[model samples]
Target: MKISTLITAAIALAATCPATAQETKTVKLRILETSDVHGSFFPYDFIERRDAKGSLARVSSYVNRLRQEYGDNVILLDNGDILQGQPTCYYYNYVATDKRNIVSDILNYMRYDAATFGNHDVETGHSVYDKWIGEMNAPVLGANIIDTATGKPYVKPYTIIERDGVKIAVIGMLTPAIPSWLGEKLWKGLRFDGIEKSAKEWIARLRETERPDVVVGLFHSGWNGGIENADYTEDETENTAKNVDGFDILFFGHDHHARKAVVKNAAGREVLCLDPSCNAVNIADAEVEITLRDGKVAEKKITGEVRDICNEPVDSAYMAHFAKEIDEIKGFINAPIGELADTIYTRDSFFGNSAFTDLIHNLQLAITNADVSFNAPLQFNTKLNKGKILMSDMFKLYKFENNICVLRMTGEEIKNYLEMSYALWTNQMKSPDDHIMLIDERNTGDMQKFGFKNFTFNFDSAAGIDYEVDVTKPEGKKVKILRMSDGKRFNAKKWYRVVMNSYRANGGGELLTRGAGIAKEELPGRTEYESKLDMRHYLAEKIKSEGTIYAKPNKNWRFVPEKWTNPALERDRKLIFKR
Candidate 1:
């Protein structure tokens, strides 16, 4: 039967049913949300160079089936980060001459109702956004993102949908930290206003003008915070660090954590908020029942559940088709361009090591031939194994499609970058009495300790450079340059080439990338080249060449212990790294 016919019949049946006998007119609004997708349309992982869990085909089947059952009552909304990650992004940016636009195909299939902007989404710059937004079936909304040139919101703040005689208002908001966190170039002339102020204003307008029976907030602002001076508080219910004065339900993204909670506004009214974990790892299903009296909603009840997508059975046909596609792309995904023997973890505390971080530093060194290399640890979704690593694995490791670039920096400029990175560590260390102080005792009073240090090491190179960071001294004071692996100290007067992602090269991480001290040179290759290289293909080639693989640690980097180590270190170590 046609979808229109199905929708018509469902609406008629719902209307004919006796409202009083049923206690409430039952309308099932199935909300299917995907946030921070970062262009993983298929189930493949670029770093692992193999098919991992999570496929858009499978997600499509689930969404389509639900929509068929509930008709117009079902809304599919993506919470942003649809761009970047995977070969899809790489192909669009580099190889695909026509700009095949992979996301367009997925959106056409899902028929998304709306989406919010994510930090990564802005990294592509405004031109790419304008092109993609024009192709999207749904509207991209964020009331606070103003185009400085026009002094107007980049997208509508909210949109109202009439589903089964009920008006549902969906509002969107991006994180306010876009400028500070992502850098000024990507944002350029854009200005991000406070989310609370934008939401309150839009909510009042939505209520006064549209009078929506239910108001739902679709936000990429992420859960509240544990970080100091964080704008948003970590509230399970509202998800906004600031209070949510309006909106009955809120769906949050970013932070990559799942939570369900109830939040109260200034008026002391309760609100429901839900956030699902990243990847296609989990899905949140929210069903709200609104009771109406004399054409107005008298009361409302909400029922929500989060389902593990990986645990669910995949549609056989969809899986088969995806498997075939993987086969075609196998050469690209499985190529064994690199090897590893030890597991790599991205999360770092005072003591733990990060293989991913080490790999990126190595890549920077190799690519730029710089005396010292530096990179920030990316919070990827999962861990990597010690054997034949594929491109797919790298894709999951750094999902953002950041381009790699080389920059020439003086010794003083390098010191400044170290200072910024050090700030993150000092800020994280909460108590002074803590053991494992960031700075070493010998270098405590040296003003030069306020600068950068460097060393070299051999760890898994997800990107392929090698460097070491001395964690014994206070953050800014600890970076020491041992040897460039090639035996070179970056010259302050003469230019030194340092490889970094375009985002970092452009000073994306609030890193100093401009002025007399720094000069940038763009590399023709894609920033996420390793990730988009087709890990499956790489892995297949690895097996063809060698049977098994081993990853060894490059011990060039070491840390000095301080007095403030976590007391629960032993227990916590088992809990964190025992996979």
Candidate 2:
């Protein structure tokens, strides 16, 4: 054959044959994260009887758009804390147990790739979370959570997701400090490991076994330097992102703080860390571009930001899909419970004695019939108006579903506990004009949303004891116990039954551990009595049986040196409340 003919035939065959597939391909990943949702599944708030600013429904609209834009590359993940907060979670968690939890339904409907089990999810106890997990379509990842019965991970430790030949390994972990807040009964048969250690171990094993192009860490704990107990801290996000050499991107929640940060790992690789805070207000977004050459990762670039879900339009389809459940929740929350004889405001609880904390205090004491009751205001500023008290009003009265507990505490321990509580509660007044409330300088803003240095929920007051708080006095010397409210002599050596919430008895606010000088490990054995039902249940029943609720402050405690404290209280209240 002629050379020209052969060349023409070769060109014709080349033109007819299929082109070579491109080995250098670019895969774009849009990682959308929702953390600490806390049961704002719908766009409405049953507790407040108002529309929520942001919720999963609004988020669903944006998530749908992203799914359409990126298709299979859009990965949806929840960083836990989905089982508590609003009335929806409470009702589904304990009240409406026969049906599927709304949380599980929302997550499954949104088609979450994975989710972590948060401490609050454990707060619902095994019966709820276990069932919820089984109902979810996606894997519930918890590398740190170990089932003591099987001596293995209670859920999937990590999940490997593949998109366009690019593999992504996601390792999920929770804070090991759950025991510090939740009682053993709630988190029974399971133990949580330190976040950093768990992440490192999982990353190491994944590297050894699976060859993933990208590694993602989905953590339920917060960033560094919080709730330090024993060797590990409550938030290991920073520690793990800095020291752990494997993870390319890390997302953490549980502290309920919105943040987007980058830290250089020990290997000099920059790792993106993002926390979208609580409520469904924000969504953490990470955009990753993977360049794959010959089916292997060649170059990768990642950038993260906090997306405002409030800006997203509410998804009508999402809302309509679960309208029945939403109506049921509303009906359950709006049901008539009893009647409030008079209004009780949480604002009054901040200064000295108030009807808000007293109501809970009385109920705690009544529930356990303990010698003394310890309580605090959970909500920052809210008032339950006079007249009808609906079932939802109970949420305003008592925030969480913590069980009533009575601890065998010595009188000295109680005094020390009160001292710690006041130390965390009030500011050290150097003079009459000095600010009385401990303002958190780091957290202060134009709104001064939360001026209190510590969480107000930690500021506990005694119900059965007459005591004085000298704001001028130092921390240890501030609280002076006069006597019991019933005119009984308070002996420091006497063993008194102290009634409080399970959160306190389990060392949540550190009133029992740090304040009373009792170690955390020994707290489980200190319980004298623990109520089977939540304190709110008893309160609801009590109110229903009585037909009318009448509660007022007993005025068992007061701040001393009225000359300095009285004026200071007024000034500080204005400053803190921004009135």
Candidate 3:
């Protein structure tokens, strides 16, 4: 063959062969996430019945600003708790039913890419949340929530999003403590598996099956601060990043805190984790860069931070969008139901039995006719002024959705319960400077400002029983029950019906299991009855029936040792009330 012929043949072969693809430029993808919005779809607080600081309107403004600047490669996500809390969702959930739920409509309008279910979302009952699942335009991912029928995830396990030829996989998981906080009926037909285990299994599966370039875990949980609980931590976002591999970023919720940090994953690669504070108060902004070589991902980088929406103005367009519905909800929540004969405040309840807590106790006893009532000031610092009581006051009084639960307990069991509660409530009066509230400011953090070392919601007190909590005594010996309200001597052997909320009955605060020494498994069986309606609803009806209420403390319980407690009370009052 001629030399020219050989050259022509070589050129033809080169033309026919596939060319190697090479990177031309780097691609920047932005991700925006909102967690634990808790039904704050609008800026208006339905309970307060006024415009508020945090809402989707403000978030919308922030998102709009980003879109205007970044040009729409932004992926938006919600980490659940959207179906409960706030009066907006409550009206939609139970009152007027719309074909397209307002929450679904709002999130759809916001253009959420994906979301997960939180424990409170599940608490809205299957019918309510199922509606959200059906109406949502985005994928609701939950790798650990198993459907009992099929033994597979009740929702989509994970979703892969491709942007500009870059494949990004987002996996979602809920905290496994659902059963511990909510009733079985609320989460019926579903099981929440461990976060770490689910992340491990799904990471391997996604790597093998999807083989995406970037993986993100959208967790409806908290950052556990390197804390471990059995196999899975309570808010296992941090732990999952530490123990699991293949995740590039993690977004957390359910604890209502704003935080951002980087942790080393199992592969020793940096994983960016962020939690936007709840109620639309904040948002997480994560920027990811993908470097490509030969048209394949060579390196990836993620930087994340939380942005405050407090200063941002409410999006006028969003406010105008939901104006009509907001007005209707306002009317319902603001209507006066009855009158408050006297003013009551929660600040007095912390020091001793006061009119604030006794009102709840009286309502519980009158409704259930139980021998005794166990009550707590759900509102940490709220006041119901004398005069007309509006429906909004009900929400202020009881912050959670709890049903009245009646349980059978003996005198000794009740005393044990009180002892455990007081131990947590008051510190031993060993010295004069003991800081009467049992607060360790360093360890308790900002929680001290709420007038308790722990969550003020868990500070339980009893009614219908005469007792004294001697802070001078040790933990086990602090509580001394004098007698029952009916002049009967408290008998240890006789079983007495006690009234409390379903949360405690179902081991919510651990008072029953840890304090009363009842096995966790036996809590459901010990419940004699449960209110058909929530306690809030009952309170409303009671007020409506009476027309006017004279709220007063029964004075059944007090702190002993007047010498120490009186002075301590005055000091603590100044500390808490700043009066």
lDDT of each: 0.58, 0.87, 0.83
Inter-residue clash pairs, candidate 2 = none
State residue 49's C-alpha deviation in candidate 2, in Å: 0.6
lDDT of 1 by residue, 1-579 (tens): 999999999999989976664454656577777777766676666555566687565577677678778988898787777776566555554344355455665676568888778877887666567667777778888887888899888887788888887899988888776643443656788888777777778888886898888888888865654222234332222434236576777887776666677777677876777776566666667888876665677777876765667645566665464464445445655555456667776544223345556555654454445545556544423567776666556554454555555555655666556555544443233443433323344332222121112101101121222234443455456555444454554344554555555555553434553222233233222122322232223333443454443433444444333333343333333433442
Please identify which of the two predictions, 1 or 2, would achieve the higher TM-score against the true structure. 2
Candidate order by lDDT, decreasing, is 2, 3, 1
Lowest-sum lDDT 10-residue window in model 2: 441-450
Best by lDDT: 2
Enumerate residue pairs that collide in model 3.
Answer: none
- Per-residue accuracy of model 3 over 400-428 as CA lDDT, tens digit each: 77899999888888888888787777889
Please report how far candidate 1 places residue 37 from its true position, in Å. 2.3
- Which has the higher lDDT value, candidate number 2 or candidate number 3? 2
Per-model RMSD to reference:
10.6, 3.4, 3.1
Candidate 3 residue-wise lDDT at 126: 86
Q: Estimate each model's TM-score.
A: 0.70, 0.94, 0.93
- lDDT score, residue 360, model 3? 92
